[model samples]
Target chain A: MTTVGEALSALCTPALVVDVDKVKRNAQMMIERCQKLGVQLRPHMKTHKTLECADIMTGGSRRCIVVSTLAEACFYADHGFDDILYAYSLPFDKVERCAALSERLDLFQVLLDHPQALEQLKKRPLRDGRRWHTEGVELTGIYAHCGNTYNCRGVEQIQAVAQETTSFTLQFMEKLKAAGITCKSSIGSTPSCSHPVKDMAQLSEVHPGNYTFYDVQQSVIGSCSLEDVAVRVLTRVIGHCPHRNQLLIDCGWTGLSLDGAGKLPTGYAMIEGHPNLKLLSMTQEHGRVEPISGPLDYSKYPLGSLLTLIPYHSCATAMMHPVYHVHSGGRLLGKWTPTRGW
Target chain B: MTTVGEALSALCTPALVVDVDKVKRNAQMMIERCQKLGVQLRPHMKTHKTLECADIMTGGSRRCIVVSTLAEACFYADHGFDDILYAYSLPFDKVERCAALSERLDLFQVLLDHPQALEQLKKRPLRDGRRWHTEGVELTGIYAHCGNTYNCRGVEQIQAVAQETTSFTLQFMEKLKAAGITCKSSIGSTPSCSHPVKDMAQLSEVHPGNYTFYDVQQSVIGSCSLEDVAVRVLTRVIGHCPHRNQLLIDCGWTGLSLDGAGKLPTGYAMIEGHPNLKLLSMTQEHGRVEPISGPLDYSKYPLGSLLTLIPYHSCATAMMHPVYHVHSGGRLLGKWTPTRGW
Candidate 1:
C-alpha cells in the first residue's frame, strides 16, 4: 500500500521516470530554438513514444513527428498525428504497411539511402502476396541519414559532416528525379541538427530525435550540456558489498542501458549527486557501483534509498521500459506508455 | 511478399533467429550433465521466455523453472508450470502482487537478501490496499545471487565465488531460522553451476539461466563453448561505404544489443564466419562493421545480403526482440513470441 506522499518512491524498483518540468523545459527550449532557426522541430517520438508528450512537443498540433518503427508510426497515426516520418531506411518487409499508412495519413514518409532500398521502395510490395499499384501508393518524402555526425568531435566537424550529408542526400534526390520519381528530401541527426547549419533550403525537413532527452553521450559528443539531460532511471540501492567495494542497485543494463559513455570515462551512468560512485559494471538485474576514491561509505547510500542516474544514451535506455513515470518537484504527475515492438 | 521458400530471409531485417536443434542439444547436454552431477536443474526462463523452450528445458515435466521478472513468472504459471522462482531480491512495491501470485501457484518464491527486504517480506503487503496474513502467504524459498561470478576470470575464481555465495546464503538462511521462519535456500549462477561442486547438501536447487543460449561473453568468461551458442541475430548489409572502411548492417544497438564482449577486445559482437569484420560502432538502427584487414571488395558483401551475428550476451540481446524465429538445419520451423513488459 503506497501512501500519497510516497507514491513515486513506492513504484517498482528500476522504473523509468521523467522529470515533467525538465521534459517540458527541454521540449519548450527545443521548440523555441528551432523557431529561432526558422526550421520546424520534428520531435522524434521514438524517444518518449507517448501521445501526451507528443502533444506537448507539437503543442497539440500533431503536425510533424518522427518514428523509428512502424509500430510507433501506427500508434501516433491512430492518435491523430497527421504528418509522420518513418525515419529508418525503407525495409522491404514493411513497404506495404508504410504505403497503407501513407494513404491514411495526410503525410507519411519513409527513408531511402541505399540503392537496394530505393529499388525496394519503388516496388512497394506487401507481405500478403500483393503489391500496391504505383498510383495507389502515396509517399510523403524521401529521408536521408547524417549518421556520421555522431562520430564528430566538435561543432565544426559536425557542420562539415552535415554539409557532406546534405550534398549526399541531394545527390540521391537527383537520382530519384532521374528515375522519374521525385519528392522532398529530409535529413538530420541530433549532432548535425544541433550544430548550426548555414543552409537547409535544399531539404524539406530536419529530424533530431535525441535532443528531447540529452544524455551523457550527448554531453561527451559536445551536442548538449549535462544539465540538459531530461530523463533518468529511478532505482534503489539493494545491497552493499564491502569486500568488493561495490554498491548493488536494482537498475541493471536492462534499466540503465548498455550504451557506454561515448567519451566520458565515468562509466555507464552518472549518479545524480554521488561524484565518487562510478557504475563500473552491470548484469541483467544488478548494477555494481564502485567508489572512485577510497573504500565506499555505506551510510551515504543506505538500503532502499532512491537514486536517479543520467543514462549514457537516453534513446537506448528508453527502449527497456514500457512506460515513463512523469513527475515534477517530487510529486507524481502521470504515466506515459511507450509504443513497443519493431 | 513472403513466399514459402524465402521464409527465413523474407520476414524482416535484424530479427532474432533461434536454432531449435541446437537449443534441444543444449538442453539435453545440460540436463544430462546436471543428472550426472546429482543436482536438479531449475532452468532460468529469463534467457528465452517461451513455453516451448521451457518445456524442452524441463523435458516436458513442467515442474520447475526460474524467472527474472514477475511477468515471466506469471507467463510460465499461466502455462501450467508448477514451480517458479523469481530470482531477484524482493522489492517493497511488488510484495502484494507476489503474495497474490503465491496464492495461485503451488510454489512462488521471492528472493530476500537484505534486512530491509526481510522486514518488507514479513509485512506481506499487497498493492490493492490489503495485507496478506503471514500464514496465508506461502513462500517456496529464499534465493541468493552470486552475481559477482559475472566478473570472475576463470573456473577457479567462479568456484571460489560460488563457495563464498553459498556460505553467505546459508548464513542468511540461519538468520531466518533464528527469526522463527524457515525455508529452503537456493544459490547458483551460470558460472558457478557449470563448474563442478563436491557438495550441495546446504542448497536446494541451482538456477543457471544463460547456459541455454550462451554467447560471446559467456565464451570469454569460460562458461560455455562458442559452438554451444544456440541463437544468432539475422541481419542484412544495408550499405557499404568504401571511403569509411565500414559495412553498415540493419542490426544496431536495438537488435544485436549494446552489450559488448566483456574482457574481449572484439567490438559489439562477432560476425558469424567473418572474423575479420569487427563491429566498430552502432547507432539505434545501424551497426558499423569495419574490416580488421584492408577492405576493398564490396562485392564480397553485396547490399541486402543476410549475415548472422553471435551476440555478446544472449539474455540482453533476446530482450530486444518480440519473437524468435525457430529454425533447425537451415529450415524455418515456427515463431515463438516472448512475454513482453515487466
Candidate 2:
C-alpha cells in the first residue's frame, strides 16, 4: 500500500504517471479485439511516440504502420521497418519530397480523399530514380479531406465516414489497379475503428492508435467504456475555499491542457471514480475543482491525498508533461519518456 | 526572395519555422506595448518554450518570467535564473514539488485561485530533513493569480477571494515581515487585467499569456482584435469534387487539430483572406473547403495554389507542427520549433 508520504515523493510532480498493467492490458485488449474481427493491426504511432512503446505492441507483424507526421515516419523507418503509411494529407509543394522519401523505403502509401489529391500523389511515385517536380506539372483538382467527423459531427458521422472511407478507398484502389499499380490500402480513426468493418475483407490493414487509451471522445463515440481508458494524471487537492465552493489544484494548462475537447466543456479533467467532482478551470499552475458529483468529502480526499484522472483527449493531455511514471502490480516499476520538441 | 519551391524545400516541412526577425519584432512590439501601459512583462513561455526565446525579452532582468510547465522552471533555474513565476494554477500535491524545486533557484512564484488548492499546497511544502524543498521557508509569496468573472459568480465573489489571496499572501508576508520577510506579490489574467485595478494593484507584478496571440475567444471577450493574430497555417487545394461542390486539401487533423474550441461549426479553421470559403469539416488527412464567396477563378487560382488560414486555438496549432515558417520582407527565413509533448 502506498502511504500519502510515499505517493507524494515516489515520483516528480507535474509528471505523467501511467499504470503499466493497464497500458499492457489496453494494448493486449485492442490487439485481441482486432484479431477476433480478422482486421490487420497497423496502429498509429502518434499516440505513443516512443521506440519503447512501439516495441510493446502485444503481437503484430511489422508489415505496416500509420503515422500523422513525416517526422514519425522517419523515426520508425530508421529502425529498419519497411512498410509505412503517411496517413496525413500533403501539400503539392511537398509532393516531390514525399515521392523521394517513398523511393528510399520499400513501401510507402499516401491517403487522399479528393481525386486531384490522388492525381498529384499518383503523378509521381517511387518507381523511377529521378525525383519529378510536381510544381512544374499542371495541376487540376482540389483536395478536401473530411474523413474524421469527431469534433463538429458526432459518432454517427464517424461511423458513416468509416464506411465511406472504405468504399472511397476501394474506388481509388480500382483506379490504381487499372493503372497496374500495387499498394496497401488502410482504414483508421479512433472513433471509426469501433464501427463494424464493412469492407475489412478488402482492406490490407487497419491503423487506429487512441483505441489503446480511449478518452471521453472515444467513450461517447461508443468505442470503449470510461474504465478502459489507460492513461491518467494523478493529482491532488491543494487549496480548499469553502467560500467559493472551489478547491485549488496543482494541475493546470501545463500538467493537463487548457483544451475543453470533451462531450462537456470540462475545463480540466475528472478525478477517476469521483464522477461528480469536475475540475472546472485552470491557470498556468493551478486547477479549480467543484464538488459536482456529491458533497466535498475532505475525509477520504484530504489536501495531501492523491487522485488520478483520465484526460479527455489523450494526445493533448499527453503533451502536458514529460515522463510517464508507470505502475504495475500496484507498485512503481518502469518509466516511458516520450520524444520532446516539435 | 524565396520562390514557393525554394521556401518549401529549404525549410523542414514539419518543423516549427520561426522567422527570427518576425519573432524579434513580435516580442519587441509586445514588450513596448506593455511598458507603455506600465504593466510588468512576464511573457508566457507556453508559446515558444525555448530558452533562447526567453533570453531575448525586452526586460534585461531574470526574476520577472512566467512559465506553463515545471520542466521549463527547471530549465530556467538550471540556467542560473531566479524569481520565476509558474503562471499555471497548481494543486496542493504539486505545491511541495514546486517548493522543493525552488531550493536550487533563487525564487519561484506560483498562481493560486482557490483556498483548498492553497491549503493542499501549504501542508506539503517540506517533506524531509535530509532533503530540502526548493521553496525556501521564506515563503516568498509572489502570489500572481487571477479570479475573473467568467469563472467566478461575479466580480464581487472573486473580489473577496482576490482579497483573500492578497491577504493570504500578506499573512504569509506578515509572518516574514515579523522575521524580516521580503517578497513580491503579483496578479494576472486577461479578464481582470483589463478591469480597473482595485486592491490587486498592491501586487508587485502582473502578466497575461494569450494577450499576445489573441483568437476569436479573446475577440469575443474583447481582449484583442482579429488583425492582432500573428500566425496562420498556409495550405493548398488538391481536389475538386463536382458532385458535392466540395473542395479538399492536405490540411486536415494532422494539418489542423480536431479542436473547434472557440470557433464556429465551419470547422477547426477558416480560409484566411477568403472569408467566403467556409471550412465545412476536416478528416485526419483532409480539410473540406467550400466556396461561401462565389466560384474561384480556376485559371488564375487553380488547384495547386497556396492559401493562408488562421487556427481556432493558436496554442494547439503551435504544438501540431514542428516548425513555424516565418515570412519576412517577402522572404522565408529560418524556423522556430516550439517545445512539444509532456
Candidate 3:
C-alpha cells in the first residue's frame, strides 16, 4: 500500500494535500463552537466542496449543508444530501435546475438578497404557473450575505456589519412574507459568524465555509490561528536562481492561486514552517520564492525537495484542483474529488 | 441554429465568451507579425485550451503548439497535434509520462532552466536504459523562460531581460551538448516576443501564449492593446447595493480568477466600455462592482443585464471555465470545451 508520504512522490506537482486529521479537528471545533453559540453549523461546501468533507462537517448525517454553486447543490443532492442551501443570490437561469433538485430532495434553498432577484425569480416559474412553492419546487429560505464583513477591520467591525446585514435580511424577509411567500432568513461569512451577537436569533443558520480550512487570510483577520489551517498545497523545488536569490517552485498561480494576501506579508501565500521564505510572485506555472530576511545557502532547498504552503485564501486555491489528496498520520487514505462547474 | 447572442441568455451566469472574430484577428495579427519577423508563431495553447482555438491558432494546419501542462500536451496530442512543447520547466515526476509521449509523437519537448532539472532528467531512464534519447524518444529542445521580463518596468527593461535569458538558454543548451545530448534552444513570453528583439534568431521557436487573448495586464506591459483582447467573462447584475455604492454580479473569483491587476486601476478587472465600473472585490460567487468616479447610477446597470469584462490575466481567468462560448458578429457560432486536468 502506498502511504500518503510515499504518494506525494508519485503524484504530479502543485497538488492539493488535505490532512484529514486536521480537517476533522477543524470541523469538530467549528461544529462545537456553533453549538455553544446556539446555531446550526450548516458548513459551506465552497471551501472543500467534497462529499467526504461534507459528511465529516455534518457529522455523517448529511442533513443540512450550504453550497456556492447550483452544480454543487445538485451534486450533494444527488449524493443523498437533502437539506442544501445554494448560498448566493439566486441566478435566474438556474431556477429550473433548482426546482428539479427541490422536487426530489427534502429541502433545497436559494439566497435572494435583493428585491430585484426575487422579482427575477418570480418571472421564472414552472409551466404549471406556480412560483416559489410549486408542486416540484420549494425554496427553503431567502439567504442574505454580509459579504462586506470580509472588508471589515476587526471583531467589532464584523459584528457591526453582521448586525446591519441581519436587520436588512429581516426586512427583506418581511417583503417575501408580504408577497405571500414564507421562508427562513439566513446570513453568514467566516468573520460575521465568528462574532456571536444578539442578532443571531433573527437568522435560521450560520454557514462559514473557510472555518474548515482556516487560511492565512483568516488568521490575519483574527478568525482563526495559523495552526487551525487544515489544507496545504504540496509543491516541489524546481529551480534556484542564484543571482536573484530566489527559489522557483512547481506551485504557481494555477496551484496556489493568485488570491491576494491581506495584512499578512507582501506575497501570494505563506510557506509552512518557513517564515523567512516568502512567495514573492507567481506566473501560471512558476512561483518565485525569496528569503524575507536574506539569502545565504541555496543548497538547503535542493531541487525536488517538497514544500507545503498555507494559501492566502483556501476557497480560491482549493477550486484550482479536481481532487484533494486526503491523508492522515502522513498516510495516503484516499482522494476526494469536488463537484466542478457553476 | 442558436445565434451566439441568443445562447448567452440560456447559459449559466459568469460564462466565458470568446469573440471569434476578435480571436481570428488576434491570431492573424500575431501570425503575420511573426512571419514579418522571420519566426514561427507556436501559439501558446494555455490561454484557450480548446482544440478549435488551437486549429485557428495554427491556421487549420494543427501542426505545432505550446502547452502549460502535461495534460494539455496529452490533450492536443490525442486530438492529432503532433509537435508539442510543454512550455514550463518539466517537473521531475512527469518525466515518465513525457518519455511515453515522446515515443509516440513526432516531436515532444520539455524545458530545462537549471542544471538540477537536467540532472533529474538524467536519472530517469527510458525502458531500454537510455536517459533523454532512445530509439523512439528524443529530447526536442532545452527551453528557457524570460519570466523575469514579466517583472520588467518598460520596453527597454524587457529587451534587456530577453537578451540575457536567450544567452542563458543558449549556454545551457551547450551544457547539454557537452553531455552528448544535442538539442535546440527555445524561449519566449508575450512581452519578449512582441518586443521584436534581434536575439530571436538564437532560439528555434517563439511560444507566446497570452497573445491569443491579450488582457489588461498585457496591454499595460506593451504586449497588446485593449482592443486586441478576445476573451471576456459575461456576467449579469444580480443586485445593486446602494448603501455600498456597489453592484453585485454573478462573476466572482471562481468565474473571473483572482489574478491581480498589474499596473491597472484598483479593481479586480476592467469592464469593457464601462471605465466607471470597477470590480472592487469578489467572494466565491459574488463580484462587487463600484463606480470608479462616483456613486454607481444603478439605473444604468439594470438587473439581469449582461456585461462583459476583460480579465487582468486571460490565461488565469480562462482556466476557471470548462468551455468557451464562441461568438462572432454578435452571433453565437458554437461552443468550445477545453481539455481539463493537470
Candidate 4:
C-alpha cells in the first residue's frame, strides 16, 4: 500500500499497485474498438470495480454493464447502473434474490447455456399470480444470462449450443409472451464475438466482456497477441540461486493465478518491461524468474528492485486483490475495488 | 457463496467450512499443541483473521503476532495486538514506512534476510546522525524479523542463520540501545520448526504459521497430512461434458486459487472427502471435475450440490474469500471474516 500525501508518494517494494493512466489508456482503447466494431460496450466491472473508475469507464451514462457476481450487480444497480448483464451463469437458487434486485432497476439481464436453469426457473414459484410475487411482494421477470461456450469445439460445439440457445430463446419468448414475462436474452463468448456466425437479429443483444483484454487463451482462438495484455502484477526479486539458475521473487501463486493458456507455458504470467525475463514456475509465495538469455539483468532484478508481471488470465488475476492501484507513468493516481462472490 | 442461514444451516459444500464448534476445536487444538511443545503460540491470523477467532486463539493476552503485511500490523495493533511481526521482507526503500509503523506500535517487527536489508538498516538516519522525526516526536527501537530457512537441513543451517541473525540483532540493538532498543528474533520456518537443531537461545521466539494447518506441501516435507488440513474451498458441479471427459462446475479461478498439487493434476484442487473425485482442469470461470475411479457417487457432485476443496497451499487458499461459512454437521453455524491486505 502507498502512503498518502498531497500527491501521495509511491511506496517501495513491488506491490500490486495499478497505474491509473494505463487503465485509462486500456479503457479508451476498448471504447474505440467497440465503436469501430459497432458493438455496445458493457465493460466487465470484475476487472476494476471502483466507483471513481465506474464513472470514468461509463463516461457518465449508466450504460450497459457486465458483472461476474450478483454482488457486483447489486453494487452498480444500487449506484444506478440499470442495464446490467450478470455475465456469469450464477446458480438457480439465487434467482429469488436476483428477482428482488431486478424489481429495483429498469433493465437487468443474465447469461445461460444450460437447460437445467430454464427448467429450474419455470418450476420455481417466483410469481404471486398477479405481478410475479417472490419472497413476499410482486415484481417481474428474473434477470437472465446466456452462455455461448460449453464443452465447445472449434465449430461444431458452438453450433450445437447456439442451436440450443436459439431454441431455448424461442421457448423462453413463448413462455414469457404467454405468461407476460419480462426477460431479455444476450449471448456471446470471445470466440463467438470475434468470429460471429450468428446475427444480432438472432438474439436481443450481445455480451463480450473479454473482448477488451484478450489473453493468450484468446490468442490461441486467434483473437489478440502477447503485446495486448492490459494489466500485469508488479513484483520484486527476493532470492537468487545462480547454481540452479532460478531467482525466487515475491510474485508467486498468490500474486499470479495458476491459470494456463492451453499448450503454452504453465507459468501464464510473463515479466514485462524486460525482454529476456520469463516466469518459468511458481510456489505459494515465491516465483521462479527464468531468463531466456543466460543470466540477464542481474543488477536490474536485484533483491529489492520491482518488476512488472502480466498474468496468463486477466479476470482471475484481477480478482486476487482487494483494490487496483490505478496509475499512469510514474505518478500515483486513483484506485479501483472489485466486488466478489454471489 | 452460501447464504448466512444456509451456510450456518446443515451441510457445508466439500469441507473448508469451519463450524464455530470446529473452529473452537481447531483453535483449541493449536493452543494445546503450543502448550505441549513448551512454546508461546503467536497465532498467524492469516489463517482465519476474525476477531472472534483471535479472541478464542489468544484466550487473553497481548500476545505476539505474525502478519504478512503492514496494513495487517496496523489493523491488529489498533485492535489491541501491540506486539507484531510483519513477516515479509520489504525493499530497502520501504524501510521508512516499516519504521513509521514500528514507531506507532509498542513493538512492531519487520522481516530481514538478505544483505541488502542489512545495508538498508545500516544506512538509516542513524548513520547520517539525523534521527527520524515523524509525527512530532522522535521514535526508536522497532523490532526486526530475521528470516533464515537454509538451516532446516540440520543444526548447521540453524546455526549459520543464528550467527547471521544474532549479528544483525546485535547491530540493530546497539544502534538504538540508547533509545531503549529491544529486539524480538524469530528463527524458524515450518520445515525447520518440524526439525529444529538448536533452540537459538539468541533468538527470542518462534513462528511456524503453516505448522498449525498442515497441508500437502507440509506433508511432503513430513509435517502433516490430509487429515491435518483443516480448511478447504466448497464448490458445486454446474455442468458435465463426457465427450471431453470434463465436467464444468461453478467454482472457477476466483472461487478456487488455481494452485494445484504438482504432477497429480495440472488443474483442479484436491477433493478431500471423496478421494476419487479429481479436478482435471479449469478456465477463468469454470473447473473441470473428473472421477479418479469408475462410476463414482455422482450424486454428491450434482448441480446445486457442494464439495469442499483442500488447497495446494493454505495461505493462498485462505485469501480467495472474504468470509468463512462455518458448520458443525447437520447444523448451520456461524460466519467469520478474515483480515486482508498490506
lDDT of each: 0.78, 0.61, 0.79, 0.59
- Model number with the top lDDT: 3
- Give lDDT: candidate 4, residue B263: 37
Winner on DockQ between 3 and 4 is: 3
Candidate 3 chain B minimal-lDDT segment of 10 residues: B128-137
Judging by DockQ, tell me the better candidate of 1 and 4: 1
Question: What ranking emerges by DockQ with the best candidate at the front?
Answer: 3, 1, 4, 2
**Candidates ranked by lDDT, best first?**
3, 1, 2, 4
lDDT of 1 by residue, A1-342 (tens): 333445678777788878777777877877776676676677788777789888888878988888888888998898888878787767766777888887777677677666676577666644444333333334446676677777877778988998888788788788978877777667767888777575655677787777777788787777778888878898888888998998888888878777774434568888888887788888788888888889988998888788888898888899888778777776667788887666
TM-score, cand. 4: 0.76
| Residue pairs in candidate 3 whose N, alpha carbon or C atoms collide under 3 angstroms | A4-A332, B3-B332, B4-B331, B4-B332
Candidate 3 displacement at residue B153 in angstroms: 8.5
Q: Give the alpha carbon lDDT tens digit for every residue of B197-232 in model 2.
A: 455555566565554454444444544456656566
What value does the interface RMSD of model 3 take? 1.5
Interface RMSD of 2: 4.9
Q: In model 2 chain A, which range of ten residues has the least summed lDDT?
A: A138-147
Identify the candidate with maximal DockQ: 3
- What value of lDDT does candidate 4 attain over all alpha carbons? 0.59
RMSD after Cα superposition, model 2: 6.6
**CAPRI docking class of candidate 3:** medium
| lDDT of residue B86 for candidate 1 | 79
What TM-score applies to chain A of candidate 2? 0.78
Q: In model 2, how large is the Cα lDDT of residue A205?
A: 66
